[model samples]
Target: MHAVLKLSKYLKPYKHFAVLAPILMILEVAMDLVQPTIMQKIIDDGIVMNNTLYIVGMFIVMIACAIIGWLGGAGCNFFSSKAAVNFAADIRADLYETITYFSNSNKDKFTLGKLITNLTNDVEMLQRALNMLLKVFVRGPFMFIGAVLVVFFTARDLFPILFFVVPVLIICLYVFIKLSITLFRKVQEAIDGVNTRVQENLSGIRVIKAFNRMRHQVKQFTGVNEELTKRNMTADQVIAALMPITQFVVNIGIVLALMLGVVKVEAGANEIGVIVAFINYLMMIMNGLMSSSNVLIQIARAIPSAERVVVVLEEQPDITNAENPVKKEILGDVNFEHVSFSYNKQVEPVLKDISFEAKAGSTVGIIGMTGSGKSTLIKLLARLMDVDEGTIYIDGFPIQQYDIETLRNAMAFAPQKATLFSTTIEENLKYGKSDATKEEIKEALVASNAIEFVEKLDKKEQHELTQGATNLSGGQKQRLAMSRALIRKPKILVLDDTTSAVDSITEKMIQKNMKELKGSTKFIVSSKISSIQHANLILVLEDGRIVAKGTHEELLKTSEHYREIVATQVEKGGILHE
Candidate 1:
């Protein structure tokens, strides 16, 4: 609850709307209170007193109050809803900015699925609470207190029954709130779990189908679905007893008020018109109490959700640009000085004591056994993660010394896995370099050996790439991704086994183009020796440590592990395709 109030600071500029909305709603409540008093006047002072003119006058007054109430209620609804939606837009914008700053560690900590849920569903829950509270928060309590005041002025003798009745109502609602908030938090966690499962299934649907694990996947998803259902039921269970309990309290109060009213009216302390008004005020108080109960229920649901959004918004990234970071020329020269890093604090390092350099206009091929930290090395060069132990530099400037956006422009690091957005083919390529021209796009596609197939597409560069490029074949996707890297023409190009799916002929063509496109440095990591055979330097890594560093031929003599990898994975693929 404290967390929610703190977040409301963003709503301060919109507070005028917030204030105006409730005041309008109070006018409606005020009309409700005044109407019954006018009816009492019509009955006692007009109809029963045989004054025809007074009856007409009182009836006209009641109609005017109804018009004011209608207009006030409409105005209240208009402003409150407007404030809620605009506030949600502001919150969503802030949340997206926060997401952009999240470290890779934090990104992996909360998977993409859970983040989507937080951004969409959790935000919606908080928005609903805001709308309800702004619209009804004031009127509910004001109506309750105002009813009591009207009752005191109209018939003070029977009103003491309310003191006992209202306290009991408040206690019941307070306990319900305490119990429901706990269950709502659990429900949100269950939703997160379900989101994770669905996201995994969708992203890896190809793998699941290839492995023939559809039933196994279905069983896993059902387990999460069942748990989510159970959690929703648990939240519903807490409120199941609430309405009956509230009704019982209201009924008891009504019977007591009637019994006491008869004694007072018989003693001439009150008239029947006054008793009638008393009954109406008592019901008005109960209506107000019920509305208050609903408001509390929304608050309970919103607390857990609002807190989740704030967690992401308030998070500070593990890596951020330092103040006054050094600006460096776009030099392709690269160096690593005894760098060591681990994704996990307690585990063995992913890359240990790794050091190497590839001067401008040179090629460095990285080869090793699986889990040899080849890909991890380039990831650090891109500032995807920090080197926990040592340092990395580009043209004598530490990787951390440049802002993230500025540094990335000088280098292109395409991962082993192929990822493409659901957009036009030209749009996806443009992400690599925003202002690429048609001739440049053709040159890059030709360099990556992708031009042949792309020219066959219905719309060529204008073709739409479906979700994850599912409509395209694997080799085609690789070609498109490679073309993106080529088009960037960065100071350094790092390809992490990106040609693994392409044919030997295509791989050879890509390597040939890299040589022709001189000046841009290339760092190729592959188990296949042919991919990096033309390198000026070769670094053989094994178990996070560098085993050998030299030309391709030099590594065959100095490194036994490099020799074995060449004998097994490379010997079968002389054409550079595997």
Candidate 2:
């Protein structure tokens, strides 16, 4: 019910459509209701009396009613399904916006595949449930209760029989629903398993082909597919098995109604037409109950999907900006004071007691061996995750004071992954500045040394951007990423090993480009020893602590850790550290 109410916010905009569809559904049900009474009239006034004109008249009335019923049902279904689809689409867009604003502290709860499933599969499930909401949810209970009440009121003698059949019927429904739900819940998890498989295969197709794992991947997929089939079959079988039982119960009621009606007719207490009409009502009531029973199946499927969506929507972000959130207005003065952090405290802290301060528009290079917490420092500045101890300030204000969007916009981040979407080169560059002029985009590309190959392509920025930037080489992708960050002109730019893929000469060229950014732009460059050689300030970290901090010259003279790092890089031909 809470999920349904939560979704109503989207439905409010289409309330007219929602209302119209249900009115039509009620009209359709009304038409169906009149059919039994019409049949009684035909039997009593026309057929048994051999009145030809009365017979023809009632037959015509039935045909016209049937047509109106069909149109009403179809029109209602059309509008309702359309509204449900549109509502789901609106919610999907909102979910995406919400996801984008999520702090990184909460990212671990949503896996990439699970997130995709929520957007596509789970939203689709909600869509189907909404469609059923308009039609079945309307038609089912109305038919059930209406038929039951009509039977009880019009044929009071037969009403007593319902006490026996109805309870059995309800019990049957309860048992099957419980069993089906168990299967349904498992089936949804199986869908996630299969989704994960497909996601992994697509993301690592290159790896699979390179390793000659075609048969192995196929075998793995087969296993999950088979499990899905088993779960689906189990749910359907449990559901299907109950239908015959329900039918048998209906048959029992029909026989009992006929027996009592005949005994009354023989005793001259009831007319033949009344007995015939009485039998028809029995069938109608059973049919209506059956329709309502199908709703049980829908509720079963919706339960698991609703639970999954609720998990995400109910998730408490590990960190969230405070209400009437504090605002920070800064031009890139960053401070990290005695900060500590861990992805999970069950594990060791990824960064511990890390402290540093950089004034506005100064170049701060972070140098370290692998996993030395250099990248973790920049993430803290980005406010991706909050520190458990002390504070991180930007321009004299704690970052937590700012809303997540404001904090992220204050900085640009290009992590080691060098991610680019399957879009035009221009679109990728415009990610930095959506309204950037063509000249500015071209200049950023040139400055990052990526303009050469970009121009070589016949379509240039208009050319197709292949998946994973597969159309370009590694070095080209890296430079293109650099261009993306540089184009943003943000207050702070943190590059986590942005030059790792390019050659020494090309790396030097990009570094020179970054140096040109020195006093005018505040930059935090994280790299192996080679990339940060020219920074005004450098921090050399060991494990999660700052073991050394100074300029390259000062560090070399004063810190043994810095000396060993420089010596190792020099022996490895300077650029080999990447």
Candidate 3:
């Protein structure tokens, strides 16, 4: 509940709407309260006296109150909806913005499916709760208190019936709300499970189809779906029971009032008109109590949602720019001094005692077996994840001294698994350098060997891509991803096996083209020795450590690990023994 209140700041912009909603709801409740009194007038002064004119006059007054009440209720709905919708929009925007800044380590704390649920389902739950709170919270108490006071003043004898009814209703509400809170939390967790299953299935649909595992996927989805349904039913059943219990208690109070009224009327202690009006007020009291119960139920459901949203909102990214960070043009002189890192401290470090240097305009190649920290090495240089121990320097100053944006902007990384958005080829390339000209776009496409296929498309560079570039071949997607990175033409270029999908001939062609960027320092990580054999300097990694370092020719003679790799690739006929 405290988490929910913390989000109240999102409502600041909509405070006017929030204020207007409750004010209108109060006016509607006041109008509703006037109707029972008017009914009393029509019955006693008009019907009992057989005066048609008096009855018509009071009936007209009731119609006018109904119109005013309708207006108030309508206005309340409009304003409340306005506030709630805008409040959700603002919170969602901030949530997304915060996620964009999250480090890889920060992202590890949340799964893709859970974050999606928090952004969509959880935020929606809070919006609906806020809407109900604005309208019902104001109307319920006012209606309940107004009816009680009216009954006391106009029909005192019937008021004692409420004393018994109200306490029973309050007790029932308290017990049901407590039970509901626990059930609703489980319901939300169940929703997260359903979302996670669906997301994983959809994202891996290709793999599932290739492996002929459709039936298996369906069985998995059905299990999660059933869990969600079961939880929803459990929570709803508890809420459903409350309405019946409330109705039963209200009906018992109505019977008591009726029985007591008959005695008073027969004794000539109260008029029949007064008894009729008292019954109407009793029903209003019942409605008011039901409304209050509804408000509390919404609060119960919203608390869990609010807590989930707050976790995201309050999460501080492990990586943030230093205060007064240096902003300078990166010269691409990179150094790592005994840097080491582990995704989880409980596990062995991914990269151990990594020390290396690459001067400006030089090419450094890293070749290692899978899981030898090849990709993690480049990610550290880009500051995607900070090293747990030791320091990394760029141009003599610690990388931490540079503004995070400045450091990242000066480097362009093409990851092993290419990621492209659902946009035109030109638009995707522009993501790297937003103001890149058409000529530069063409040059990058040519350099990455993507131009030939792209030119054949009906829309050419304007051709739209499906999400994740699923419409393109694996090699094509990698080429386009490389083009996006190349278009930036940064001081430092890190290709983390970006050419793995391309043919050997095309890979050589792309590497040859990369050499034309003489001003940029390049780091290439690949498994194929042939890919990095011509590099100015090469590092052979084993496990998480650099086992050997030298040119391909130097390492071939000096390092047995290098000789073994060369012998293997040579036997496979992938590379010649030069």
> Top model by lDDT, which number?
3
User: What is the lDDT for 86 in model 2?
Assistant: 90
Model 1: number of backbone collisions? 0
Q: After superposition, how far is residue 551 of candidate 3 from its true place, in Å?
A: 1.1
Q: How close is candidate 1 to the true structure, as a TM-score?
A: 0.96
- Taking all chains together, each candidate's TM-score versus the true structure is 0.96, 0.91, 0.98
TM for candidate 2 is 0.91
The better candidate by lDDT, 1 or 3, is 3
RMSD of 1: 2.0
190-306: candidate 3 lDDT, tens digit per residue: 888889899999989999999999999999999989998998999899989998888899889889988999999899998888988988998888889889889889889989999
Q: Rank the candidates by TM-score, best first.
A: 3, 1, 2
User: Taking the tens digit of each residue's C-alpha lDDT, what string does model 1 give over 1-578?
Assistant: 56787689778879989889999999999998998889888877987899999999889999999999999999999999888888888888888888888879988877787788788878888888888998777778998999999988778898798888889989999999898899999888989988999999998998999999999999999999999999899889888888889888888888888899899878878777787788888888888887887888888998998998888887788888979876665778888999999989899999999999889889999988789899888889878889998888888888898888778888886667878899988888888989999988888889888888989989999999889898988888888888888899888899988888888877888888878977777899887788888899999888999988998678788878777777876457555333
**How accurate locally, in lDDT, is each candidate?**
0.86, 0.79, 0.91
Candidate with more favorable, higher TM-score: 2 or 3: 3
Of candidate 1, the 10-residue stretch with the lowest lDDT total is: 569-578
